[model samples]
Target: MRITLHEVSKGRAGQALPSMSLEFHSGAVRFALAETEQRPTVLGLIASGRMKPDTGRVTIDDTANPKELRRRIALVDAPDVSDPHPDITLAGVVGEELMFAGVGATPLHARRWLTQLGYNELASTPIGNIDPAARVRILCELAVLRDGVDGVVLVAPDRHGGSPDGWWRIAGEFADRGYAMLVIIGGSAAVALERMQEFEAINASGPVQPLVLEAPADADADADAEPADEDAEPELSAAEPAEAAASGPWVAEAVEAPEPDPLEEEAEALREAQGPASSIEASDTDTDTDTTENGAAR
Candidate 1:
């Protein structure tokens, strides 16, 4: 169960999300930086094959079978999309999700299932009042209940107000069970995860490398066409990434790869549109504080 996003981006220029290229396979958790109110959901939708990117494409196991992606990938807790109502009781939420999973869906069944999970005490509480880590755990548990779901895209768990590590550990647990995991989160959460990464981390975050795009499809012919422009693009070939489908367990060496200039140029434009914002690589957590987001869509 591998998932790849090849330069997959949504919206037009100066809009929701910037171009992103990443890969993650089963038993690994991947994170992407998306701070805006809409970027997280947009990325989740695109990654889960529920929506199409305006530019690039989404693939599972190196094939462009989005329909299969829809079946195998579960998009969890995306606001205004898959999220349960804030006012809904925990039991109500469980019952509804159980219905989707084709299980016993009555209130009693939901309560019994909650008991099995040791969460019966919270059954009468509103889902919005659930702790952030517990919320992620419950939603994800229900998500994997679907027949063919082998992976999960958990969107904006940071918005719920908790230590990023709380939900990160929960996601890692699912990945350890052989489910591919992609968590779309704010820049601050991404920074937190990157900072916690050990030299040889066991719970590694997949594909946090610098942006590296693949060479164009007609590389052989195109390479020869620009012979006169050799000095102008001296480092382009070396900067090309490790093919389009490099999906597997997270590796530190791969994340340290240098990026090409073309993606940097486009990313610069994206930054200008986003105002003064920090990238996921920013070491200072203070830099991710977006006062300007009050004026924007945030």
Candidate 2:
């Protein structure tokens, strides 16, 4: 899915916003610099299709369709539209959003949801006091829970106060997960991010510059990789295990040797109890490797 705002403006005769054009599509996160306290949010609302632009148009996949755009794009942290009440407890916020998401909305369900998101301990904390990056993370997670949401317009996260890298990374992760993301940020925040780009190899994949990793990947693949012939599969199989040795130690450290089935393990333990005692050899495990994974080490 892709969303594009073409010279879109809002408010009295477009005075509220000068025309601005920007585009973001599935598997990408784009940033827009809006300095005013309210323009940042207004831009987000326009980008997400929550509010109609008084001037140009916002389109989904290059077609002018407000309903579809609104359905697919989640307006995250838009002031007065999606922001949670400052005083609401974290659990309360989750419960309310789950209600909107048509999931079970009971407190127990909310607690479980937060636990899975690794925010269980913050359940009782006021949303206002939560860390800014965490606030953006939880809110973005909740926004995606709504059916049909495949994109997010995160508004003014910098206004919450923290390094732009914090929430920027989070947005990049969403994009990596195949969600189209647009982050509306302040001018100073954008400047800071510009300086940050020197030392960090951040995402510049957006048509515009300035993107983050909070899973920022472009699915760049080796187009040059040669496909093996069908008859070569058996030949390749013999060498595959040897090739896997580079990842062996890392994989082992990530995952312990598989346990036997329950009954077998129990029998093995029983046999060990009856067997004579023997000294166990110690092995070094501090080795490191360049192995990488999209999945967990374990």
Q: Which candidate number has the best lDDT? A: 1
Q: Worst 10-residue stretch by lDDT in candidate 2?
A: 215-224
Error in Å for residue 170 of model 1: 0.6
CA lDDT for candidate 2? 0.84
lDDT of 2 by residue, 115-153 (tens): 999999999999999999999999999999999999999
* Candidate 1, residue 50: how far the Cα is off, in Å: 0.6
Where is model 1 more than 4 Å wrong at Cα? 199-298
Q: After superposition, how far is residue 134 of candidate 1 from its true place, in Å?
A: 0.5
TM-scores for every candidate against the unseen true structure: 0.66, 0.66
Candidate 1 C-alpha lDDT tens digits along 32-124: 888889989998999999998988888898899999999999999999999999999999999999999999999999999999988999999
lDDT of 2 at 96: 95
